[model samples]
Target chain A: MIEVKNLVKTYGDKRAVAGISFKANDGEILGFLGPNGAGKSTTMNILTGYLSSTSGEAYINGHDILEDPIAAKREIGYLPEFPPLYLDMTVKEYLYFVYELRGCRLPRNTHLKEICELVKIDNVYNRRINNLSKGYKQRVGLAQALVGNPNVLILDEPTVGLDPKQIIEIRTLIKKLGKNHTVILSSHILSEVQAVCDRIVVINQGKIVADDTADNLSRELTADHKLIARIDGPKDEVIKLVQTIPGVVSIVADMQRERGVWEYNIEAVEGTDIRRELNRRLMSRNWYILGLRSSELSLEDIFLKLTMGESVNEFLADKADDLEERYKEEE
Target chain B: MNAILKREIRAYFDSLIGYIYITAFFAGSGILFSVSSLQYGSTDMSGMYSGLFYILLVLIPILTMRTLSEEKRQKTDQLLLTAPISLTSLVLGKFVAAMLIYSIGVCMTIVYATVVSFFGAVSWLTVFGNVVGLLLLGAAYIAVGMLISSLTENQVIAAIGGFAAMLVLYLISAIATIIPVDWIARIFTELSFAERYSPFTYGVFDFSNVLFFISATVIFLFLTIRVLERRRWS
Candidate 1:
């Protein structure tokens, strides 16, 4: 387990990490989501005792990283953004060196055998690290971190430059590792974090904006009900009819998907379900209701909304206005 | 500390830098022995070690250039510093590893001493004094190079800086002669490592000179540790 309290890292005039704090519980996968240069790496570095924070405390298993680094570091296995590997050494040599360097009390042969198997790097164990592919090099880096079997793993952008197949492989490995070790993974890739992390902490400009589960974050950020309806009716008449319905906040007609069919996105009052009433109204008006469905903000939308600090309704309004302006130009 | 020492030693041999350094060092010492003792047909090895002193001006840089600089350039310091070992032990581990390699190279010069003894009577005490002096002086030089290496990530800069620093220390006695004042000249001469080491080459193992070499090595090693600690703050 790890805990950071009001951690601040300032580089002279600029602050790289400005008073941010979060925790990764035991056997949990905590994703640090942020754009590039959002202090994610800085936070990870401070946690791993690689870089000192300007102020505040980071504790690993009740030991402060600064005051008691050796004890604190003993509980951590860190893989920096650029894996710290000696390319001249082979994979087995590098991991063995790390094993001895961390002062592992376990039998070296059995311990290394297990790590090589867990990260599935046995095939490249004899090859020089620099001679391997980037994916294999990353696996060796992961193997280095697992040498001592530390309780916590701090991985900074573990899948930054890997190919799609390698990314999925590494993600699967991390998910498997999460069954025992507490993991704090940082990345700018949204879907990667959404796929593997149990809890998400969104950081922006050295500040934590939102901290919740993936589902909880999107659900909490969504404040209004949304519905998409496909109806065979005149566009203007449909818009006017939807506006007349109570609890309907706004309606925008989407581009026609089929001949004589109009799609409209409807925003209703919070906690309101106007789909049934609207469907009945459209049917009574002799408009064929081809499709109707309820919708909510996606994780991508929630991330952009919270980080950009823009209201969803305002964004949609601007988008609709832009579409209408283009239509007028085309006319 | 042991892990770092083993790895550095293994790295040196694996990458062929150890063999190159040892071969280069012995070649330099062989050239010096041929000129100083063999051609002259003298059994005294003091002059040969004196010649070795100059060879060390270049060899020490090569020996220590990659000790810390390569770690920085390759970003391996992140792994080392984040491990459970203390920084003092890390720096000391590197210092001892360099010393061990340098000692092995210096020990090979004993064969020259053995060859000299076959021709005539060679003073074992004189050989002992020069060996001690060489080790002490070489340790100080390695420490200087290690400190310089910690200042930059580029091995070239570290090597050149280390050579320049060693050259200045080697020439301190000569530079002292050009001083205008008596007191200043005396201070420069006292500060000259060459002045301290000259007595040992004459087969005199002065305790003060031994202390001088040791304290210089310790000071520089301490400086290297301070540089490492300061890096974390900056």
Candidate 2:
């Protein structure tokens, strides 16, 4: 288990990591999702004992990182944003160096061979790291981290630069690693984390804006009931008919789809399903209901909303104001 | 520490810098030895030892420049720092690696001394004393160069900075002679590495000078550890 309490790191006047606290249970893959300049890398560095925090305590398996650094570091295998590589050394030589550097007690040859095979770099093991492709280099870096078999693996942007196939392969590997190790992976890519992580901590501007399972976060942020409908009728008539339906709170003609067919965005009262009611009302008027679907926000929209510092209520209010302006212009 | 020591030593041999440094040391000392001792058929090797000291001012930087700086530049310091090793061991490992390479060049001087013994009466005491003194002095210089290397990520800057720093230490006695104030000049003379190093060439085994070189090496190594530790907090 890893726990961080009120960790803060400041560089001069700029606060890079501002008093963030969280915990990762054993055998859990926790993803740190953030944009550039967020404190994901800084926090990872501190956790790995590479950088000291200004005022806080980080514990790895009950040993405080600052007070008992050697023990804490012994449990962590870190792959920084840029994989620290000795370009002059071959893959085999580099892994051996890291193996000795970490003071691994396991049988050296078998351990290294297993890691090389696990990362699928056994073919390129004899080549110098400088000659390998980016994907191979990243695998070698991951292989470096796996040498000592530390219980906690801290990876920063592990798939920042890779082809889609390689990215998937790495993601699969991470998922496999997550079964046994407490892996903390940081990435700016939302789907990567959503696909691989058991839980996510969404950080923005040096603070965590949201933390929960991906499904929980999606469910929590998407509480406001909204629907999209395409109707074959006069735009104003469709809007007027949709607003009169019971439990329908607001309706706006979003955009014209085709000749006399307009797509409308409608909001309803909480816990109300407006789809059936709106469909019945529109069909009763002989206005064709071309298509209708509830607009549940995706994780991408939630990510933007949380990071941009715009709450869901504020977003809905902005849309309401836009609707009011459009109505006034028509009048 | 052993792992780091082994890797650094291997790295020295893996790149051309280590070969160039040792070859240059031998070549530079050969030219000086031939001109000062062999060409004149002089039995005294003190003048040739002094010339090797000057050659060290140029060659030591080449040996020590990339020790720590290249680790930072390539981000390999991340691997070293994050490993379960103390800062002292990390610094000492690299310090010892550079000293070992330098010792290889210093050891060749013994062969030169033996060669001279064939031609005429050679003071083995003075030659042995000079070898010990040179090793001690080279340790101090390597420590200083390694300290400068830890302060920057650019190898070129580390090399130039190490050269400049060693040059100051080499000329400090001459610099003292030019100073107007008596007490300040005396202090400069006291601090001059060359001033302390010259006595061993004459077979004077000054215990205090040995202590001085050892202490300088220890102090610089300590400061290098501090620099690395300070980087983590910063």
Q: Could you give candidate 2's per-residue lDDT for residues A1-331 as a string of tens digits?
A: 9999999999998999999999999999999988889899999999999999999999999989899999999999999999999999999889989988899999999999999888899999899999999989888888898888999999999997788998998999999999999999999877788889999998877888898997786566564478888899988878888888888778878778899999887888767887777778878889888887778665556666776654755676577678878876986
Candidate 1, position B100, lDDT = 96
Clashing pairs in 1: none
What is candidate 2's CA lDDT for residue A280? 85
Error of 2 at A90 (Å): 0.6
TM-score of each: 0.87, 0.87
What are the per-residue Cα lDDT tens digits for candidate 1 across A1-331?
Answer: 9999999999888998999888878999999988888899989989999899999999998999999999999999999999999999989888888998999999999989998988889998899998998888887888888888999999989987788987998899999999999999998877788889999999888999899997786566555478878889999899899899899877877779899998888878768888778978888899988887766555556666786674755776676567766765876
Docking class of 2: medium
Per-residue lDDT for A2 in model 1? 90
Clashing pairs in 2: none
Error of 2 at B80 (Å): 0.8
Q: Which window of 10 residues has the lowest lDDT sum in candidate 1 chain B?
A: B44-53
Q: List runs of model 2 lying over 4 Å from the truth.
A: A221-304, A307-311, A316-331
